[model samples]
Each structure stands twice: as C-alpha cells, then as structure tokens.
Target: MISATLGIEIERGVRKLLDEAGTSWPSELKVLVDRPAHPDHGEYSTNVSMLLAKTLRKSPMEIANKLKSELEHAKIAEGIFSKIEAVAPGFLNFAIDWNVWLNRHREYSAYQGETEKGKVVIEHTSINPNKSAHIGHLRNSCIGDTLARLLSRAGREVEIHNYIDDLGNQLADTVVGILHTKTEGEHVRFGDFCWDTYAKVNKVYKGSPELQEERTRVLHELEEGTSSTAWIGRLTAEKIVREQLHEMKAFGIGYDVLVWESRIVAEGLWEAAFEHLQATGAFYKVEEGKLAGCWVLRHGGEGSGEAEGTPSPDPEAHQADKVLVRSNGILTYTAKDIAYHLWKFGLLSQDFTYMPFADGVWSTDSQGQAMPFGRGETVINVIDYRQEYPQAMVKLALEALGYKEQAARLLHVSYGVVSLSPETAESLGVDTSAGKGSYAMSGRQGVGIKVAELLQVMEESIESKRSRQEGLSSREIAAAAIRYYLLKYHLQTEVVFDLRQATEVSGNSGVYLLYAYARAGSVLEKAGAGQKGSGKALMEPPVPSFDGGALEPPERQLLKQIAYWTETMDAAVRQLAPNLICSYAFELSLLFNNFYGACPILKGPDDRVELRVWLTWKFRETLGKALDVLGLPAPDRM
Candidate 1:
C-alpha cells in the first residue's frame, strides 16, 4: 500500500515538474518504487528520472534534482517523506518519516485489496479419472489453490474448476483391463485397483495387438455412451474421480465445479466447436498425404494459415498440422479442449447443466438444474509445462475463430514438473542409476508416489516430531508441510520430492513459519494480552502514540519488513506467483527472529517494552495474513 501511495505521489510530482517547465511528456509514464538494499540510501528509490532523460534531452541528474524538488514542495509530501534526495546518475531516493510509517500501520492495520470487476476461472488439478493422484498432481493442486486464494483475497471473483478427463485414453485403458482381465471382486479402494490395472493394460498394449484393438473398441464405446462397456467406464471414472477429490480435500484444495470431458462430448460441445473451427477455417483436410482424410489444425511453420490449398515448400512441413479429428472419426484431446475453453470465456451460446455435487460444489449433469458457472471474463489453465504446445494450440484456435480478445485473456499458468529426487526415488524402490537428475514419474510404470502415500509419510514424520508440542494435530502439520514444500519453489523450478526435506522444521519450511507464529503468540501471552480493546491503542498515533526515538536498529528493520506485506502481495498477484508470498514470509520470519534476539520485549525498559509489544503484534498480523494467502494453517503454539 505504501508503494502504491508513493507511486501516485511520485507520478504527480514528476507531472508538476514537467508542467512548471512547460515541456511535453509521454502520455503513459511508468513509475516504479523499489525498497533500497541499504538503509543509508533511503527506504525507497526510483529510476524514473533516468528513464525520461533520453526522451526529454536533459541530463539524468538534472531531471532527478527537479523531480526531488517538486516532490519536496508537493502538498501531499508534507509529514510523509522526511527526506527526498537525488542520487548519482538519476535516482530519486526517499526516506519515509518514522512517525508517518508507524501511523500507516495504525490507520490501516487490515488492508484488503481493491475489488475488481469480472470473474476469473482457474482450471487446475485436471487429473484423468483413471488412477490415484501423485506428487505431480499435488503440485498442480497446491499452485492452483494458492493462486485462487491470492486472487480472491485481493478482491477478484475466482472460480476454481477441476476438469475430469473421464473419456480419455487413460480411463479407457483402465476400463479395458477391468472388463477383460480383472476378476469380478470387491476392492477396498477402487482407485488403487485401477492404478495396477492401468499399468498392466499399458504393458499388454505394447505386446498384444489384439489387446490394443480391444482398448480402441472400449474407447469408442466410452465416447458413444452406450452398452455395458460404456456403463463400466462411467462407473470407474466416477469412483476414481471421487478418490482424487478426497485426496485434494485433505490438502485444503476444493473446486467450484467439475467439468467432465465426457459431458463435453456427450452434450455435443465438441461438435459445435468443430463446426465453428470449420467455419473459421481453423483446420483443413489433408488430401493425398500420410495424414490424408484427417482434419488438421495448423500449429507452426510454413503452409500454416496461408491460402487454404497452398502447397508446403517442404512436405515434411505437414507434420506441423496437429490432427484434430482422425480419419477414423476420433476426436483428439486438443479438439475437446478448444470447445471447453470456448465455453470458459462465454463465447459459446450453449452451457452445461449443473447439479450439486457437494455443499458449495457443482458438477455437470445431462439432465439437471442449471446454475451460473463459467462465462468468465478471463480463464487460466494451471497445467504443467509439458502441455505448453497443446495450450498454445487452444489459444490459437480462439484467435483463428476471431475471438482475439478472448484469446488474450486465456492464460496457461504453466509450471515445471514435480519429479522424484534420486534419494527419494531409490527409497521408493526405483532404480536411479539410469537417471542423473530427478526422475520423472511414469504412471504406466506404476512408479510414482501417490498423494495418499506421501501424506502418510509426512503425517508419520510430523507425529514423531509432535513429542515436543501439542498445539497442532498430525493432519495439520502434514498439510502445512506438503503445501509449503510444493509452493516454495518458483513456477519454472522443478520440485524434487523428498520427505525428509519437506518435513524438516528448520530453514524455509512451513514448520518454521508455524513456530515463528507461535513465538509471537507466546510473547503476547507473556505481555498479558495488552489491555482489552487496547489492540488498536498499541498502534502509533491518535491512540497511544509510539515513541519513534525508542526504536532500535532491529526494531526499524522489523518495521520495514512489516511494511512490505501489501506491496509484496500486490506483486505476487500481478505476476501470478505464489512463491513470492512464501519468500516474503520466510524473510519476515528471519527478521522477526533477529529482532527478538536484539530487542528484549518483556524485560526491557518500560517505554521500549510497550513499543516492542506493538511491533510484535504487527508482525504476527502480517505473517498470519501471508500464511492464509499461501493456504497454510497457522498454529498458536509449537
């Protein structure tokens, strides 16, 4: 909030300087405020003067000086900035008045982000309804759930969707295995049984052409939605999807609606999409080639979206055409996805019927009451980076269909894959000698750690550590550890799953944050809760005035960290990066611990003690808010 406030003031000051000189400026001027690394320079610095130097034909230092003078004389700058200086080359540095900074905390202790108009639909954790979820799926769910929380907390209406690819090849394989090879017997967890059956079917398909033919047959029946085989596939997909939902719920992930891939096909959504694609010339028939009789959507390279019948310079260029509908009349996943996204942006006139799946959850049904879903102004698909090309094609389809604005609003929030660490892989009985870095899990090989299995290990590890504290349950600890581990890495960074590292309480982990929160609570408890309703009185200004002179070096550093809470959140939301919040929380925790060691809160001088208690309260509130945004539960004691 300080950054936003300063940004506005700085822009106004620059405009005033230009107005005084009677000089023209760019219509759109971007002013950025960054916290300086060293305290001596200033609390915040800007390089806008340098950015404008070349355009204005003036020396950078001259522009910075003029801007600084204007800022000093500005009416809004009174009592806000203690000092404004022009540093070398062209940097405008500002030091906030200590009293003013404290006053901001008192004035707005609970800052909610400004509300925005329109809805955002985020589709994530779209696992195939075939087997149990693995660590890879957990990464998708955690990232997506945190993103939803961040956007919603920032005052954006967000709808979380979990797409169930029930009619895909994975489920088809499971169905084939169940109908042909497996015995008719009851299983405790149907998803677990399907997991093994899925792997076995993949192996059989590799060796037996006859079994592969059966798999293809099962796929067709599943798509047609008729016969016993289709009925079995539906039942199996529903069962597996339920298990996946349960696993995600354990991690505090929930969905606003379930978009079934089968329903997208059954309701003729893809048929409508195909008609639109043909109408827009988004795809063409490949005549007299290897892909003859197939409808292909152009991806990249030559002969792509040129004259319809234009011959490629190289016949090999035809490979760029991704087959949408095969000669055999089978629709590819990309084809259905185009339809799904079209429906997402409300471009399609049709909509799916919805039924209550759970208390605040809805699922698509053939004959059910309709409800408001989809029709989003923006759509974000939180999928792994491996599917980048597929997602790109979906956007391309939108653009080719003349929905250019809708295409712009469609974002693929891609992240790197979650792989097994060499040690963890070996621990899982997987041979790591063949691989050098992290080993990517193969579902067909049945070699990935299930979400359930990982949770079990994390819960057991936390239970062992709970001998020292009773503030958090084993389940709470497990959720915190898993969520933190998955979110701590940058979006492009691949997470190498390791149980030991995830469960560790020391260093940038969720467990560390928990202990930090608990420490603040313990300090507040020792301070005797600070006079009832005196909570607001603890803040500087108008209530119990804070003695700015009593603040020590560590206390100032702590306040600086606390001041960045909203600024950090704004950046995280803008960049769609949840790891920013994680990093901020970790850094804030370190600063608080340092401050705790350097400044005694309870036993210090009376004035310093009261000031430190207020600082403690501020830190606790800020850290707790960040944890909530990260979807990590805060524990009172540890």
Candidate 2:
C-alpha cells in the first residue's frame, strides 16, 4: 500500500497548508498518484498542488514547493521517502528509501485492507433455465465470481445469489414445446433439448395465432401454480436449473443462495410490495386509451401522473411509461423485480423460506425451513447492458417509495455481451457478414458457442501446443485463459471471442500469466537446490538488506510494481470493477517476465542471487493471490 500512504501524506500536507493560511479546504479531496512515464521522475507523483492552485490563489509551482517543504518536515516522511522534490508545473515526486521499500515487501500478503461495513448481495448468472449456458453467460458468471472474490479479499461479507427466472416466457415456451412437440433425443440433456425446441416453438408462435394463445395460457398457468401445465413447467425448470448449476460448477463459480422468481410471486413478496408502491402513489391505474385497465409507473414523463387523465400534448418531453401490471391482472417482470429488490434491501416485511438445494447452498422454497438470505444493505446486480432501463426503473421505484438511501446503494453492474471474432465465427460455420461488424450470439437461434463446447475447444487447442509438458492439463489452462479473456476488457467493451487469441502463451491472455507463474516456480525450485539457498532461508532475513547498487533496472522496476498490489486491490474493490485486477495481473506478469529475462537468478553472485530469488518469491505470492481473485488457476507447471 505504498501508493496509498503516499497519496494520503500528500493530501494531508495540502490540507495543513490550507489550514495555516486560514482558508477552508474543499470537502472533496481528489488525489491521484500515478507513475511517471519515465523512471527518472520518481516511483510515485501526485498533482494535489495543481488541484489547490485555484483555491489557494497561488501558482502551482509555488504551492508544490511549499507543500514539498512541509511534507519533508513531517515525521512520517522521515525514513519513507529517500528524496522529496517539487517539479515544474505542480507535481510532488516521491522516491522511496530503498531500505524502507524492501521492508514493506515483508508486510505484503494475500489479503489487504480492513473490514468494511454491511453485507453485500451480488446477483449474477440469472440465466433462463431453458438452455445450456452460452459464452455470454460465461462472461456474467466470471465477472460476478471475480467481484465476489475481490470483495471478500478486501474484507467484506459477500453473499452470492444466482437468481432463477423459472417463471418467465423462456421456460413457458420450453414447457409448451415439451408437452406438444417431440423435444430432445433419447440421449440428450433436457437443457440442450430445450435450447433447440424453444426456438422451434417461438417460430411456431409467429405463424400460428392458436399456438400464441396456448403460450399465453401456459404463462398464466405457470404463474398461478394450480394446473398440470404449471407442474410440468416446475419439473422442467428444476431439471434444467440443476444442469445449469452443474455447468457453472465446472468453472469454479458457486452461489450461497438461489432465489427463484416463482417463489417471489408465490410467497406474497410481490403482493406486499405492490400494496406499498400503491400507497406511495408510484402506481396508477390507466382508464383510457390502449393502456386502459393496466397499472403503470411514471418513469419521468410529462403526462405520467398518478391520477388518470388524458395523454400530454408534448410526448417528446418525457420518456415512455413502464408497465407494472397488465390489464389481464398479470404482473410484468418490472413489477416482480421491484419486489425482489425490496427484499434484497430488507425493506419488505415478507420473506422467503429456504431449503437446501446443494451442499451448503440454499434456494427459495414456498413451504420449507426459513433461513437468512436477503436483507442486504447493498445489492449489486450483474446483468447485461441491454436491461439498463429495467434496472433504472427498479431504482426509480425505490426513490418514489421514499427509500432514496436504499436506492443509492443498489448498483447495476452492467457489461457488454460476448460475440465471436470473424475467424472464430467462420470456424464455427457461422455466416461471417450476416448482421453487424461483430457476430452476436443468440441462444434461441442456437448459433453461439456453448460454455462446455468452448472449454473443450480451448483445451484441445492448448493440448496441441503443450504436448511435451507433463502434469499440465489442457482443461486447467483453458479455464484460466477463458476467465482472463472474459475479464480483460472494459465492462462496456464487447468481447470478440477468439480461441487462438485466448490460448496464445506469449500474449496478454491467462495462459501467459500461468506461464509466467510457472517460470517463477521453476526458479524457486532451482534456487532451493543450488547455491542460491532455499526460499525459506532467503526469506529468513529479518529485512531484505540488499546492496542498493546490485539492483538492476529490471529488478527495481519489478519491485515498484510489486509494491502496488494492495493499492490495486483497493481500487478494484472501490470501483466494483474486476477488469482492473485483470489489467494489473497482466502488467505484473509482463514486468516479472522482463526481470527474469534481463537478470540471472541461479548463476549470479551470492547476494544478487538471494535478492533475485526473493523477488521471484514475492512475485509468485503476489501473482498467485491475483490469479485466485480472478478465479483462474495458478498451476505450478504449464
């Protein structure tokens, strides 16, 4: 946490200077500690002086010099900074005492930061239980799982929830297809069969109004839970959900609870929420026009009042209204979600009974043992970017209910979908130039890579490359590669899934991180047997007292990055972004590889060898923790 200490010190100094000058400091302190592009500037630099120039009515350089002088006099800066200097514009450059820098490495471990307040409920992988999980679903699971790991590592109580939308139209279509048409072959899984037949029924509904009416009937019956059709839907959804859980388990993603949409409806949670919303004047019954008899929520519209009236003349002034309950007395998805969120934030009096679905895992039950699941102070929904409006409506409903504080705590962690690269699409026999630039996958069309199939393809690809390497399973390598690939990009960027790119050992893929880790492990093994001494013996030194001159360019560069591990984790948790961890892990690997190439470990002088080996051990520990947080395996060998 060197970066944190430096940033904190600089900000503290700026505030002190403002206090002495009898001027009030700004409430929001924005301090950024960034590495200078060139190494000569220093290990870390901050621009707090520039931020204070306007407020203090002084030149940036004048403020920077004054702050640097004051900081150098502070007690905490005695042994920490080797030199403190102010640059031209307003940069406070800090060079750490090499001796003190080596000591901080000893304090570094896997987990960082103190315990944070409140329990966090993260809902992810709410996939329709009608088909095998596609690559898009894999992205959601990987992102959510990694975020859970990140939060836990940073000392927060995290509860993982895999919501089941079993009562939705997807499962309804699958049930109708199962009862009316031939679904699945003799040896296929129910999930795979539903994936295909679900599409076929949707096509049937488009052509046959009779089939459409049957689908509507099936939806109502499934919600009401009193007919044979509803029983079939339940059985089918349960089977498919079991298969989906098994599939997710293959990727090392597990959930503490499984919240069912049907339970939310059946357990009176939505009924209580509807009554509360009605009391708050957030919902109104439409009496005229096409929407007559329906209850709608005004999501910022000119004529979207609680009282029934004519439509406004200026239609462009407001966004479209959101339907809560249809005229047919059926609640829309948005209505159910409002209730779900109320339960999440512990605002609703109603609760669900929980039953064990798996070992140490619970699912919502209508009449089972009651267990603690919801009542989270903070809830993060890991869903796709396409559902932004629905998520916004949930927050708006919270605000309209006068729970604005709870609404602020509800976060929508949205990510773009995973599509196929041109090469991968062509290889999968997909039409390349069909739609847009990147080929999007569709579960109903059965035209995307299944998670299972993608893993198999990646394993096969890796096996061909590492046939000579023993005790290295292709599946392990593929898991790391896929997880890293899905998380390496920004949340808003669509992933162009490519097998060749993902499996490349020299690139910024997960395989490269594994390879770098393996190389460090080998170095440790060689050092243990050779004259460099065992890792324990090398680490036994109370403080890493190395000859300052022995540290080369690469060694110093690697150490600088290693010092930022805790700082990186802190930022990742604060932003609720796992891509930051991916970027840090990749950069750390690159730095380690450079150090390994430029410096000799086993053949160097005694002191130099010890120092290099210790650095390798540090990298191994740091990178291993990062890989674990990313849900990627750090194999000893590749």
Candidate 3:
C-alpha cells in the first residue's frame, strides 16, 4: 500500500507540473514505485522522471529536480515522507516517516476488497481416474489450491472445480487391465491397484495388436455408457476419483465441484458446440488429402477469415489445422474442451445437472437436479506446459465463434513438470547409477512417488527431527513442508523436489517458517500478549507509539516489509503467480527472525519493549495471513 500511495502522489505531482507547463501528460507512462534495495537510496524510489524525459525533451536530472521540488512542497507529502531527493539519471527517492508508517501499518495489510465481479472458475487437479496421484499431480493441485486461497483472500467469488476425465484413454486402460489381468493381493485402495494395472496394460498393449484394438473398443463403450464394459469403466473411474480426493484432502486441498468428461458428452454439450463452430464456417470437413472426412479448425492461416470458397495463398505455410472430430466420428479432446469452456463462460445454452459428490462438493450427474455452476467471468485452467497448444486452441475456438471478450478472459496457468532429484529418486528405490541430476516421472512406467507415500515419508522425517516439546503434529508439519516445497519456485521453473531440502529446519524451508511463527507465538505468550494453545487468538494490546529516530535498523526493515503486504498481494493477483506469495512469506520470516535476534521483546529496555512486542504481534498477524494464502498450517508450537 506504501508503493500504491506513493505512486498516486508522484503521478499527481507529474500531472500538475505538466499542466502548469501547458503540456499534456503521456497516457502510456506508468508511475512505478518500488522499495529501494539500499537504505541510503530511501525507503521507496521511482523513475517517473526518466520516463518523462523523452516526452519533455529535457534531461532526466532536470525533470527529477522539478518533480522532487513539486512533491516536497505538496500537502500530501506531510507526515508521510521525511525527505524527497532527486538522484542521477532521473530517480526520485522518498524516505518514509517511520513514526506515521508504524502508527498506520494495519491499514497497509493485504487488501480484502473485491476487485472484480462474478465468480472465478478455477479448474485444476484433473488427474485421469486411473492411478494413484504422483508428485507431478501434487504440484498441479498445490498451485491450484493456493491460487484459490489467494483469489478468495482478495475477496473474489471463487469456484474450485476438479475435472474428471473418465472417458479418456487412461481410464479405459485401467478398465481393460481389470478385466484381463490377475492380481495376487487383497487391494486396500482401488486407485493403488489401478496404478500398477494401468502400467501393466500399457506394457502389454505394446506387444499385442488385439489388446490395442480392445483399448479402442473400450474407449467407444465408455463414451456410449450403455454396455457392461461401460459400467466397469464408470465404477473404476468413480472409485479411483474418490480415492484421489481422499489423498488431496490429506494435504488440505478440496474442490467445490467435480466436472466429469462423460457428462459433457451425455448432455449434448459438444454437439451444441460443434453446431456453433459449423455456423461460423471456421470448422469444416476436409474433402481431400490424408485429412479427408475429418472435421478441422484452420488456425494461423493466411487470411484465415477469407470468404468460405477462397483458397489459402500458402496452405502448407499455415499451422496444421486442429482436428475436432476424426473420420471415425470420435470427438477429439479439444472438441469437448471447447464445449466445456463455452459452458464455463455461460456462452453455451446448456448446463450440467449437479449432485452432492462429497461434503460441500458437487458433481455433474445425469440423475441430479440442475444447479447454478460454471458461469465464470474469468476461467483459469491450471495445467502443465505440455498442454499449451491445446489450451491455445480452446481460446482460438472461442474467438472464432465471436466471443472475443470471453476468449481474452480465458487464462491458462501453465507450469513446468515436477521431477525427482537424484538423491530423492535413489531413496525411493529408483536406480541413480546413471548419474543423472534429476529423473522425470512417468505414470505409465510406474516410476513416480505417490502423494500418500511421499506425505508419509515427510511426516516420519519431520517427526524424527523435532523434540518431544514441540506441540504441532507431524502431519501438520509435513503438509506445510510439502506445500511450501512445491510453491517456492517460479511457476515455469521445473521443480526438482529434494525431500531433505524441503524438510530442513533452516533456510527458506516451510519447517523454518513454522519454527519462526512458533517462536513469535512463544514470545507473545511469555509476555502475556497471546493466548495459550491458540494460534489465531491474540490479546489486543494498545498500539505502540514510535519516537522519532528511536527505532533500530532491523525494526525499521521489518516495519517496511510488513507494510508492503497489500502491494505484494496486488502483484500476485495481477500476475496470477502464487509463488510470489511464497517468496514474500519467506522474506518476511527472515526479517522477523533477524529482528528477534537483534532486538528482544519481553527483555528489552522499558522504552522499546512495547514497540518490539507490538512489532512482533504485527509480524505474527501478517505471517499468519500469508500462511493461510499459501495453504500452509500455522502452528503455535513446532
């Protein structure tokens, strides 16, 4: 909020100066303000003068001096900035009046007002209902769940959806394996059983043409939903989905609805979408060449909007047209997805009937009553980078059908895949003698760590490291560790998960964060400022007044960081990156730890004790909110 407030004042000053000079301001210029890396530069700095130099035909230094003079004299700068300086190359640095900042810091906490209207439909964790969820699937779920938390924290109406692709090849393979293969043990989980069965079926299909044909036949039967084989597919998919949900629930992830792929087809949604595409003439049957009899949507073509009979200047130069329906009449996944997105934006005429899938969650059902769902003003799909092309096709289809605004609102939060560090893979019984730095996971090869297995491992590891005096449960610590590990990296960076690093009690790990939070709570309890055995209930104390030039360097640093919480949330929302929240939380924890070491709260000098305690309380409050957004548990002790 400091950055925002400062940006507004700087913009106002620039406009006033330009108005007095009888020159119009440049509409393209943005007044960007950020914290200066060095304290000498000031608490916050902006380069607006540099941006205006080109338009004004003046040197950056001259523009900066003028702007600095204008800002220092403005009424708004009183009690907010101690000094405004014009530096070389057009930088205007403003130092905060720490007394005023400390007094009003709560006002700068993360914004809780709604910035957008209507519901946000976030589709994620759409794992195929075939095998147990792997680490890769865990990354997707963590990202999606955290995004839901972040959006909801910013006061948006969020609807979380877990799409079930039961009619896909993965489930069909699992069904075929169940009918053809024999197992030796009593299965505790249908999903765990299908995990191996799915791998076995794929291996066997490599050598048996007849088995391959059977997979194709099973796919058609699942789509038809009439035969006994279809029943097997449905039962297998539902059982596995329930198990997957149970697995995610262990990590505190849940969804608002389950949108099944079969229901999309059964409700004639894809049929309606096909008609809409055909009406636009962008979708047509290929009458010649290898694509004959197939329906396709031409993309990236030369003059793609030409009249219906006009030929392309260079057909081969255009990207390959996406197949909507094959010659065999099987709708491609893209075709169904187009229909699903149309329904997502409320552009389609039909809707899905919903039934209770779990506690407080709904599922699309043929025998259920119709309900309000999937009319999101913004649609975000949290999928991997591999699906980028298909996602783009979905957006392009929306645009081709004249829903340009909806197309623009459609977003794909694409992320890199999760792989295993060599040491982690070796611990999981994977051969690391090949000397590879990391190993990619394959579901078909059964070469990945299952979510349940990984969580159990993390819990045991954390329990071994903690003293008996620690009050938090191992499961809570494990969830925090794993969630933070997945979220601590840039979204596009491939996460090579190292279990040891994730569970470490020092240096940027979730366990470290939990320990810092517990330390803060301990301080608060010892000072009689926080309730015993409660993480959320803190005793309300009088706001501490700061004496001018009385604060230590560490205290000032922590206060400045705490005040940036709202600006941090704003950036995360605009960029759609949950990792930003992770980074902010980690940095905040470090700052708090540094302040606790250098400045005592309960034992400090009488004059500074109250201020330090209040600062500690503010740190705890800010960090607790961040932990909530990151979907990590806040523990009073750890």
Count clashing residue pairs per candidate. 0, 0, 0
Tens-digit lDDT track for model 1 on 1-638?
A: 66777889988888776777677677676898998888777678999998888767799899999887777777444466778889988998887667776766655345577465689999999999998889899999999999999989888899999998877889988998887676344646788788888888888788788988887888899889988999998898888888888988888899999999889988888888888888655477777667777887777422355765454445466687677888788888998999999999987877899888874779999988788899998898999999998998898888888888999999889899988889888887888888777887889988888988788888888888776757878888888889999999999999888767877878988988888988987888778755336333222212235656456789888887887788888889888999999999999999999999988888856666777887888888889899999888777767
Off by over 4 Å in 3: 19-28, 110-114, 183-187, 301-305, 309-319, 426-435, 530-536
* Cα lDDT tens digits for candidate 3, 94-152: 87777777666666564855558778999999999998998899999999999999889
Q: Judge candidate 3 against the unseen true structure and give its global Cα lDDT, from 0 to 1.
A: 0.85
Residue pairs clashing in model 2 are none
lDDT tens digits, residue span 184-205, model 2: 5653577777888887787777
Q: What is each predicted model's overall lDDT from 0 to 1? A: 0.83, 0.81, 0.85
Clashing residue pairs in candidate 3 are none
Note each model's CA RMSD in angstroms: 3.2, 3.2, 2.2
Q: What TM-score, computed on C-alpha atoms, does each candidate reach?
A: 0.92, 0.93, 0.95
Clash number for candidate 3: 0
lDDT of 2: 0.81
TM-score, structure 2 vs. true: 0.93
